[model samples]
Target: MIETKQTMMNLPGPKAKAIVERDQRVLAPCAGRVYPLVIDHAQGCEVWDVDGNRFLDLAAGIAVLAAGHSHPRLVAAMQAQVTRFTHFAGTDFYSESMVQVAEALVASMPATHEWQIFLTNSGTEAVELCLKLARHATGRQNIIGFFGAFHGRSYGSLSVTASKPLQREGYFPLLPGTTHSFYPTCHRCPINLSYPDCQIACIDLIERVLFQTTTPARDVAAIIVEPIQGEGGYIVPPPGAMQRLRDICDRHGILLILDEVQSGIGRTGKMWAFEHEQIVPDIVASAKGLGGGMPIGAVLARAELTRPWRPGAHGSTYSGNGMACAAALATLDLVQESLMANAAQMGPRLMDGLHALQHRYPQIGFVRGRGLMIGVELIEPETGAPARALANAVMQAAFQRGLLILTCGVSSIRFCPPLIITAAEIDEALHLFEQSLQACL
Candidate 1:
């Protein structure tokens, strides 16, 4: 059965329930809620829960599995690496795997001679490392971040992430000198100005904050952006929004940091999502799909950006283990081939299907984003305030129907299927999505 509730309850999913119960009782409450299906094993888009019920996973582990789960390439590469050494003292002894991965990254980066690389384990660590690079490069302290953007959950990245209050709750006295400005959300803009015609009020606000306002350019270390704000409803900035930010950063001598942790490595139909814009960031944070399904993060920058960072600037044990590097190298090859092409082709199909659905349902206020990184925004038909409740209902319904989807922003549902998804799979996911939205309505 491809996702029936009866099948959902039949397999090891029930036995896994015991593990969840024990985890909740003994483990930390901060673990948060999870959908009932327990993933037993997966291949392609189909994952069988403990109950032996198969479901289509559209979420793809929060955009980490762009090449799909347990692909033969990744398996073969990782299996080969398993016989080799895994970790080494990264700072003390450099591994050939990380060195080779860095070489590949530099080759993929924009035609620039200054692409230096640093390896980390996760997206959060990548951003954390990004901050250090900017600080060490510019000798500045303050940081300017866009509202509703999610960088990561660590202290440095979390402080910049202007999402829910709980994400920042109890983590008070966050990285100081960080300021939030209006995000370039074309739909339901905070500034209430029309896009393209308004000349991007969000970008204008950044100018106001830095040059005209109290945020002196001298103290600012870097300007961080998501290119396509992943968690912030997949909001795409206006045509010139990115270049404007680039100009502002250049005028002020501030480093431009792109958090491609979720958007990079072919997730957005490009090797780097920022390539859509002609501008180049001083430092880029990348993770998620960089290591295939395994965890790996990296800070890609110009050679000059890391000049000030000394030998011990940053160090981590698993920065680029043999397995992670092998998997990442294999992933890079896999994505640079067919998966990216599929994402470019399939993302628009899904978006068009969603837009058609939005025409039928007023609850879907707006839809925006690029490539496979798409979001359907929820809005109250009358008041126009964020329809968080509606978003939750749609997400829950989609999960129940065996299509794994995720929610984001104050009122939005994000769709980041694996780049390897086929046209038929995208259509099928949209079919389930339409049913979920109807039920939600």
Candidate 2:
């Protein structure tokens, strides 16, 4: 195993502290920083702070660096594209890079359906476009979303995002005709029932409750969801949950939109998490790792659904820019060639390690996830209640111990390392994570 040695005993070392202080004075206060990690540079799964402190990066810029930081292939692609051209307003003009990227995205979709693509600059934009298309295509106003899902922060996306109150606190009176229902969180069943035995009642609630009382199924445009809830605790819905939703959408003629922003691009072993369920969605919103760090997003939909969108229906200046498309093509190439398989292989090793640690730590209430996108829920040892404070403390402790991690949901720490992470890196991260847990206790 590659040993991680920390050169600095104290965190926020001199240079990092100065830069952070400068940032606070000029930068906006809306950004919620979990810890004071001022990255100077990074490669693979390793990072260096401004103060020369070395750390293992498990967060991967919130799981954006699929091929790891500054991969030669991505850098070269971007550099070459910059020399030829950067942006020519993709909405109005055509570019080979843009066409190629769109083709690549369509190719990644299930073979059962032919897909069309609309590019954007971020996941929020992709979701926003999906919302508009769903309503336009179906001529319906009402939409359905699940609780504990973090789609994005834009108006339409935020309206369906029920993950955190802070995200929707003051942005109320959001997009009209949107409602939320329970997500099948088996760990803490929202309906106070068990999985497999519960028969996935949460999904049925949409038809039985929401459709009957508030929004009629005929008036609903789409049902947006994450294959694996990202910010909402990496909660993986049990088997048949997805198929049930598919059935409901098909019966009601409502579109099924999968927000693969954080769960796509091979983060979950499969190219797209929805593929695991063997049901093709009407639309898929992809970003995060799509560009390997460059800003890019795409709304992929069945060709029939998008055929109604006329010219000037929607557009963005930077969407499908040559530079972003080039970077994305490189990222897709890297993922298909090797990084994707690496995620599948390393995920088991990391999961096994965390499960073993759970045996030693009573605070670990649950461990769940697919491939490299995993979560470890920390709870109160005596009462078995969610320990939010302990979760935050452990995250901070991990950072101080030269391991970069972040917490999501109420009491879970998420591990979304780069897809290029190796066996030694996984073992080292597990070691640092155990030490962080010990220190927190």
Candidate 3:
């Protein structure tokens, strides 16, 4: 495994503690601070805390660093672009980098049909734009989202998000005409039904119950979903689930929107998680790893659907900022070159190790994911209930052991290390994780 100082230092060292003290005074309360990890710098999958403590970053800034931290290519591209010019009002004016970024995004999409892109500053913006476009194109008012799905935090995107009650608490009366349906989670089925044998009834209910009783299919503009639910837990829907959704959308003329914010950019082996189902989405929302840590989001939609919008219909000042575009181009190049394939190759290695750990640790109720975007759900051994506190404790314990991990859903530990992570690093992470588990126990 990767070598490191064998002894673990006292966490939140003097320097980190001081920074935390200052941050607590100035930073907003909403800024969720999980562990006291004051980062000084990072390279690849390794991070150095402010007090010189080292850490293996399995979270990757919530899976935004597809090319790892401070990748030379990304740094070079950003430096070169900033020196040339950073922002030129991309929506009002033209920039070659902006055009090239859009071109690259279109080319990366499925070749079955022509595609177009609308660049934004984050995945939330992309989702907001996608929702707007869906309504505009279909002349419909209603949208369908899955339960336990997170689209974004913006007013429009947040309307469809239901990952946590806390996220939507106090901010009520989200965008009108938005309804939530049950996501096909086989591990703990919402309807208490088995998979395959259940015939994917969760999706069918949208038509049989939802459309007929509440939001009519004729008025529903779109059905937005995450191929692999991220915050709701790294829950991967069973096979044929996506195809069933696609078929429903086709029959009802509802647009299919895939929120690839976390699962896109080769995190799930494929360039986009929806590809795993061999189905195409009308619009795809991407961000997170797209810019290799730089802030950039995009809405890739069928060309014909976006034609209704006039010149000044929808736009953003930083829609295609030169620096962001350059970073995106460089990041996409790295992902396409080998990182994508590397994720596909290394994913099995990591998952196999996790499975072995599950066999030994009964608390690991379920392990599911694709590529490097994996999650291990912790449950009580006797009751089989979600061990939410145990997951949090394990995450904190891992941090103390020089490993950075995060919890998602109710009791799942998400592992989304940078795509550039090596086999040795995975082993090291697993070892640290098991140690943390034992300590927590």
Q: What residue pairs clash in candidate 2, if any at all?
A: none
Query: Which prediction has more favorable lDDT, 1 or 2?
Result: 2
lDDT of 1 by residue, 396-430 (tens): 77777777888988788898888888877887788
| Global lDDT scores for all candidate models | 0.84, 0.93, 0.94
Off by over 4 Å in 2: 6-8
Candidate 1 structure lDDT: 0.84
Q: How close is candidate 3 to the true structure, as a TM-score?
A: 0.99
Write model 3 residue lDDT over 1-441, tens digit each, in one string.
Answer: 456443456688999999999999999979788989999999999999988888999999999999999999999999999999999999999999999999988988999989999999999999999999999999999999999999989999999999989899999889999999999999899999998899999999999999889988999999999999999999999999999999999999999999999999999888999989989999999999999999999999999998878999999999999889999999999999999999999999999999999999999999999999999999999999999999999998898889999999999999999999999999998889998899889
TM-score of each: 0.95, 0.99, 0.99
Per-residue lDDT of 348 in model 3? 93
lDDT of 2 by residue, 1-441 (tens): 557653325788999999999999999989989889999999888899998888899999998999999999999999999999999999999998899999989999988988999999999999999999999999999889999999999999999999989999987799999999998899999989998888999899999999899889999999999999999999998999999999999999999999999999999898999988988999999999999999999999999998888899999999889989999999999999998899899999999999999999999999999999999999998998999999999999889989999999999999999999999999999998998899889
RMSD of 3: 1.0
For all candidates, what are the clash counts?
7, 0, 0
Backbone clashes (count) for model 1: 7
1 against 2, candidate with superior TM-score: 2
Decoy 1 TM-score against native: 0.95
